[model samples]
Target: MRIGMIGCGVISQQYLASFDQLPDVQLVAVADLDPARAAAAAEGREGVRALSVDELIADPAVDTILNLTIPAAHADVDLRAIAAGKNVYSEKPFAVTTKEGAEVLVAALAAGVLVGSAPDTVLGTGTQTARAAIDEGLIGSPIAATATMVTPGHERWHPQPDFYYTPGGGPLLDMGPYYLHALVTLLGPVASVIGAASRTRDVRTIGSGPRAGESIPVSTDTHVTGVLVHESGVLSTLVMSFDAVATSAHPIEIHGTEGTLAVPDPNRFSGDVTVHRLGGEGWEPVPTAGGYEEAGRGIGLHDMAVRGPELRASGELGQHALEVMNAVLESAHSGARIEIASHVARPEAVALEDVRAAT
Candidate 1:
């Protein structure tokens, strides 16, 4: 498949490299607000052209458009791609709000085009192995889960990280999707969300970097705490913050009647996944069967480029994640528990031998 990429930022480079390695995929064109940035990104790349966003979307050679713009621009880019009658693969948080996310979904459905988003970490072997273990009843019935993400705000290293402190870019919307998607994958659809959010600091100092000690005014919530009620009666407490110090807590920890599974950080697609039985003395590592040998940084985008439309995490699963994440933010804002309206069916099991063979 031939694809065009919008927003040639740092993450886009990873996508470009992975696409280069996939024999079936081709990077047809690239577009960015800055022509120089887009040209520089496309330079020395084989068989790719630099064009305006409209021109790239209109290109007959491109079958799909990868939306890599900032959080606020996601919906607009997706809507334009849908109007152009092209499949779209977007970055995480689908949109800033539930209403915007729903609109993107509606447009995709109406246009008969496929739409996928990032945080496809579930497609990685780490998550798939965990899923297999759960399906085998190794963990018994899941009862509760907890996810935490704490970091010193983003003004430290990102060349253009100012947007992260603004309205459409906070802990809940910025880093929540990874954990939320993992929750939905391991558990089921979230039935309701009760949350509280706050802006802990009016201004944050860049901790470490060349821009160290720089001050950035914060406009969005820096800390968020929520309880997510899944359809299976599993309660998940989610905590995300940009104002707190780091901790030893795993990104995700699920407690089942039989045992507790310690999942790797959701920010990464591959890592060591361990499980500890209720009475076990120590954690036992679960070995991965084979799939993508080297987990690409953007595993979701890589999988979509290489595996085509059949990839598990690229379709309804992504949409479901977006819906749940948006619901969480809405719950925090409205001071009411928000119920998710969208549903994603569980994916069918794939044979381990099949995955091994694919590699």
Candidate 2:
């Protein structure tokens, strides 16, 4: 597959490396609003040519277009790629709103092209091992889940982090996808959501980087809490914050009738997983058979290496997560529990022996 990258930012480096490692994929071209940035990313890359967004999408040589643009531009770029009859693999928070994500999905379906989004972290070792254990009935029937993320703000290292406080880059849209994807992967589609959100501080001071000590006015909600009712009757409490501090806790925990499974942070691809049985006094770590040692590369590469298909942790999961998170925000805004319109079934489990046989 000839892949064209739309944005050449920090995350794009991971995509570039993963695509380069794949024997079936070729990084044919790249596009960025900043010509210099695009040129820099294309440097030393074989067969990579920097082009304008339009040119890259319209190019017949490219089979897939990776949409790595900022959150606000996701829908527009995806629509264009679909119109050009190209498959799309986009970054997380597929769009600023579920409505926009729906439009993109419709376009891709009409165009007869596959559309997927990031937060493919589920394909990572941490979430994948958890899924395997759940499939084996190690945790039995999940009854509840909780995910918490508290960050000081991205102004620290991001060269252009101002957009993070904007609508498309808030905590719910930005970091919510990872945890939400893991939840949906472990459980199933969320049936309803009730949420509350607020901006604790009007401005924040940058903690590090060249912008250190600089004040940034916040425009979007920085603190959000939501209760998600899954179709499987699992109630999940999700919390995100930019104004507070949090102690060490598994980013996600799923409680089941037979046992409780504690998953590592969902932000990265691979980590340790533990399960505490109903009668057990302490948590016991579940040994992972096919876990990756690296972080971001694990999920994407594992999907490609193990499944021989892109859907493993591919862009599709990211799009689904985007819809779920947007539903939470919408529910918060209307002061009512909102039901997500999209339905994403939990993936079927693949046996480790089968995976080994294929390998």
Candidate 3:
């Protein structure tokens, strides 16, 4: 797959690094609203051209678009790419709204182009191993789960922290995809959700970079909690916050009749998956049992490149997760349980294997 990466931001660095290790993908072109950033990204890379965003999308040599743009631009970029007869792999949340996300998927489907989304972190060994444990009945009859992600705020470190506080940039929307995607992967599609949310302040002061001390207005929920009723009847509790100081809780914990599974943070590619049997003494480390070993951000794109329709981090799953999240927020505002209209099968598992060799 020849990739034309549409946003040259901090996250793009990880994908660029992974492209070198992935034989199935090629970084053919790069683009960003900031032309200089695009040029810098292409510097010293063999045969990589830095083109305008429009030029890159129109470039017939590019088979797929790696849309790393801001959340607000996700669906637009994806739709444009699909219209140009190119496949798309977008960064998370799918889109700012469920309507927009659905539009992107519908367009891609009609165009006969593949669509994939990020938070592919689930395709990594950490979450995959936990799934394997449940599948193997180490944790029999899955019952419930708890997912927690808390931080003081992204303003503490993100250079351009304005977007983190906007409509599409709150704690749940910005960071929930990783956890939600993992939950669906471990449990199943969510059937309904009830959520409550709060924001501590109206503005956040930037704590780093040239914008230090600059305050950005907040228009979205900062601390979001919800109960996700999975289709399988498992209830997952979620707590996503940008107003918290710290936490010692495991990123995710799945409880079942036989045992419990401790899942690693879904933001990364790897971690130790520990399991505690019902009658066992303590948590024991589960051997890596599934997913691409030593994977990275672009592994989903590689999965799409290799698996075609069988790709795990597919747009259907992405849109389903996106709708589930939006429903959570809507439920918060309406004070009612929101029913999810979308459903997706849990993606196929990746047996423990070196991604580098697969390519």
TM per model? 0.92, 0.91, 0.99
Q: What is the lDDT of residue 12 in candidate 2?
A: 84
lDDT per residue (tens digit) for residues 1-359 in model 3? 99999999999999998999887889999999999999999999999999999999999999999999999999999999999999999999899999999999889889999999898999999999998989999989999999999999999998798888888889998999999999998998999999999989999988889989888899999999999999999999999999999999999999999998999999987999998998999999999999889998999988998899889999999899889888888999999999999989988877888988856
TM-score of 3: 0.99
Which portions of model 3 show Cα errors greater than 4 Å? none
What is the C-alpha RMSD, rounded to one decimal, of candidate 2?
2.8
The RMSD of every model to the true structure, in order and in angstroms, is 2.5, 2.8, 0.8
lDDT winner? 3
lDDT of 3 at 123: 92
lDDT of 2 at 21: 40
Best by TM-score: 3
Clash count of each predicted structure: 0, 4, 1
Error of 1 at 276 (Å): 1.1
